[model samples]
Target: MVKEYYDPEVKYMLWDDFQIRHIDDLKLKVKGYSDDECKEFDTTEDILQFYPNFKDFIEQFFAEEELVNSSTRLNYLSNYADTKTYSVVATEQLTGRLHVNENLFKPSPKVMEVLHNATYEDVYLYDLTREDELAVEISKREEISTDHILIHSGSSDVIKTVMSLVLNKGDTVLISAPSWNYYKSIVELKMAKAEYYDVVPGKNSYEFDVSGLMSKARAVSPRIIIITTPHNPTGAVISASDLETIIKENPSSLVIVDEAYLGFSEQKFDVRHLLAAYSNVVFSRTFSKLYGLAGIRVGYGLCAPMAKQVFRLDVNPFRVNNISRKMAVAALRDEKYYKGLLKDITESRNFFINEMNSISGVKAFDSAANFVFIHFSENTDVQALKDYLAQNGYLVRLWTEGSRLAMRVTLDRKETMEKVVALMKEFLEK
Candidate 1:
């Protein structure tokens, strides 16, 4: 039997401190776990063998870790509530990710049938420039020119590719406060600065600060400005006229309008038309949202002809997979299926907002997208409320901008949402 270097009973206790990012203390604790009686290995799997309980820790904690420069590091958000169980609702998901009960619609049966008939060999395509087939289809739907479209895996991939192709070192990028955090991290990864404009909460909904955005554009002269329609977390949108004005105001800068949730918005703007009118306008659309093809992972964008050339240079021949390509085409073609899902989501969103607002100290904003933005009164203990929700088997995306404690809660199916609202009411009272 191997002699243990550390007390076996207390070994697991170290994980608690490690989780809160006490790296120095964690390093000290790890040395004790190393046994001089056994051979040492540097590989993660081998290290896990010596520390058996570290399996899940390694898998979850370090998967998306980013080492920023020399001094800073990035850590992923924790999913404190267990996601596997039905009672532990995953309201944290911001995408149009459907629950099992929400599968009222699906991709066309013909797509699956065709896929079955299709051979694996036929899936590979030599065309690195996916410009003609799917791009043309997207152009037709978005009312943009074929030369302006590029098909990619998803919005995240598209954003990375665009950043790589467009930004230079020390250049600035502008995004809204409380927008997608990934955008800021990616901008930093490219060695560009990220500046944020504020999104002020209004009487019934959140409003974008178009003037503040313009002011920042003039002050920083950002290389790119990312404006998400039916914006993430807040569900606020910049109107078509406002978006065009911003583009016109910042003629030298590239303005990217992310329309990932546009299909679910109450007011859908045709920002694709700006592609033809402006040299620096880029509009991204994803099948992840209204199409309910989040798993398929297909997203495309409309940009200037010059931007397309840069994208071609940056991207490989087979950027998007065969299954994603075909499935996206099928999903896009099936308008009826998406329309049904949209109706269901819209109804649920409204119901959720109304129900949440009815609770004392809770202010649920009307949402244009699938998730609703909510805030608690000053008297309410926001962190305590979140803990209560998690303990009661409901998980939500909680965000803070200054003094505000907001929750971006996903609107599940009507039945599920009704139960969640009831819990919220009870929790608020408590």
Candidate 2:
């Protein structure tokens, strides 16, 4: 009798009694599985029954295949929309695309005032002083010296510059699975080998599998390790103590912490002590999320003096424009405005998680950031629900893992959250 098995690692579907042992030359190497080695399924539905997480993606794959092979393809060809074009159309109609969590709130009025009052020097002349001025403001805020702060166009530029500076061909880089994903891409771009540690789902939120990370770090002795706090998509954070433990364990490796969502998280920890103790740590922060200064594209990194010196060699002295630097400085000084925004975000996030959890067959995880991660039970028609939400002018980020169909929804205004919850219930009832 023939049986089917799915490889979650490489997302391959295997037929017959063979299991994939490895890959070579773009082909899977298979060996017959022992009775105890693999789970067997007679049909795709049976596979779904046993592995709930694969249900959504597997079903969608099959559906798409059927659509392509059937008469529907020919009939629709004249007016067909490819996935990319369809996405563009859908995005154009969205009330707001919550997938990215771009701040709907405006930046501090001071930022606008500075931009409005900008002179020709701010636009045409070389940025000589503003970057230094912004660094001084950040140094005061972070309680770090100006020499240790590296200002860039955005945190992403920092990551890229660091990778370019540090990564040699075939150097091993360790990062968490289900992380920013861009980390993996950049590592590969540098011709470096990327190794992943796990980030497992927990009762209330996703958590770092720290022990697993340490194990991988020991085995690979990776040159760089990247950690994200108030982690993207999952909204989980690594405690400062745990972070220190990781840093202490791998003394030789450069540990980079992406704290782009810093102000949104409720958990507070100081990195000043860590910076004082370790020279191998880099903490990246951005004005994009909390300050609503994404349009300005200003970000900075706190690094040790030694690391800063090496990074400076590759960084442009005038990377940030004069206008952007001044605007970022303005955002920094308006603490009261940001505090009020943080309060509203916290309330909206709480309301969203609570309401989502109240729905049958749905689980909304607690988050430390401006978004919530939601999981739908196997029985839920997630694709249908996603379509319904999109039709109603809402858009969210969606993906699937073993036995789970999940989405990350950005917290918007309270009224928008209420409408979303109501629409979800309306879809479920139908």
Q: Highest TM-score: which candidate?
A: 2
- Name the TM-score of candidate 1: 0.75
Candidate 1: misplaced stretches above 4 Å?
Answer: 1-118, 122-132
Report model 2's TM-score to 2 decimal places. Answer: 0.78
Model 1, residue 243: what's the lDDT? 84
Error of 2 at 69 (Å): 31
lDDT of 2 at 163: 82
Model 1, 288-330: lDDT tens digits are 7776676777888778888888887767666577666767777
lDDT of each: 0.71, 0.79
Worst 10 residues of 1 by lDDT: 80-89
